[model samples]
Every structure is written in C-alpha cells, then in structure tokens.
Target: MFAPGQEQLSKEQIKAGEIQASQTVRSAVAGAIMLYLSPFAVDFVKKFL
Candidate 1:
C-alpha cells in the first residue's frame, strides 16, 4: 500500500539525515583534535624557537 514516490522521499530523507549527522560528528572530532593539539603546538614553538 505504499506509494512509490513516498517511499523514495522517505529514503532520501533518511539519507540526508545520515549525511548531516556525519558532518556534525566530523566537525566535533576536528574541533576536539584541534583543542588537544593546540597546547602541544604552543609548547613546541616556545621550546624550539
């Protein structure tokens, strides 16, 4: 009883949601990495130069 177009629309919505979630996670991970590295980088610069 499912309409053909409706099914496709739902699938597209699910795919979009997954893509958005992945992008958000990627951004959060990148921020965390930068936060973790910044102090080390500053110390390295001070120590070496």
Candidate 2:
C-alpha cells in the first residue's frame, strides 16, 4: 500500500523496531511483576518491625 513511490521500511529497520518494542514491553512486564509482588516482600520486612 504505497502511494506513487512511497518506500516501506526495510527488513532491518522493521526488525530493529520490533526488538526495541519487545525490550520495552519486557521491562514493563517485569516492573509490573515486581510491583505486584512488592507487598509480599514488604511483609518480610514488616515482621522485624
């Protein structure tokens, strides 16, 4: 779906974007997992207090 002569992304460019997106998504999921489990971690610390 190109107009007269519009160029699409090259495979390398697309792959780079995909890798960057995946890395960002991975970090976000990791952060969410950490946040989800943080209360459990705090429980241990609370036991000493």
Candidate 3:
C-alpha cells in the first residue's frame, strides 16, 4: 500500500506526465502540418503567378 501522502503525489505526477505528452503531440502535429503544406503552397503560388 502507498504511504499516506504518496497517493496524492502519484496522481499529480501522472497528470503532469499526461500534460507533457499532450503538448509534445500538439507541437509535432503542428510541425508536420507546416512541413506538409509548405511544398504544395509554394507550387500553387508558382503556378498562380
């Protein structure tokens, strides 16, 4: 069994870990979207002019 105050501390640790993971996912997705769009955007602009 966990010590008296350990359960609360464990919960906080789990929450912090989840938040960090979510932030990482968001950043990666944003970066990927930008990378994927850049080439298409440039091509479109080149053709439009």
Provide the clashing-pair count of each candidate structure. Answer: 0, 0, 0
* Pairs with backbone N, CA or C atoms under 3 Å apart (clashes), candidate 3: none
Alpha-carbon error at 5 in model 3, in Å? 18
RMSD of 1: 5.3
Over 4 Å off, model 3: 1-9, 44-49
In angstroms, give how far residue 18 of model 1 lies from its true place. 0.4
* lDDT, residue 12, model 2: 100
Instruction: Summarize candidate 1's per-residue lDDT along 1-49 as a digit string, tens digits.
Output: 2765553457788899999999999999999999999999999999999
Q: What would the TM-score be for candidate 2 when compared with the true structure?
A: 0.76
lDDT for 49 in candidate 1 is 94
**Residues 1-49, model 2: lDDT tens digits:** 4597878889999999999999999999999999999999899899978
Measured by lDDT, the strongest candidate is 2
Off by over 4 Å in 1: 1-9
Ranking by TM-score: 2, 1, 3
**Using TM-score as the measure, which candidate wins?**
2
- Cα lDDT tens digits, model 3, 1-49, are 4676554548888899999999999999999999999999999999999
Query: By how many angstroms RMSD does model 2 differ from the true structure?
Result: 2.1
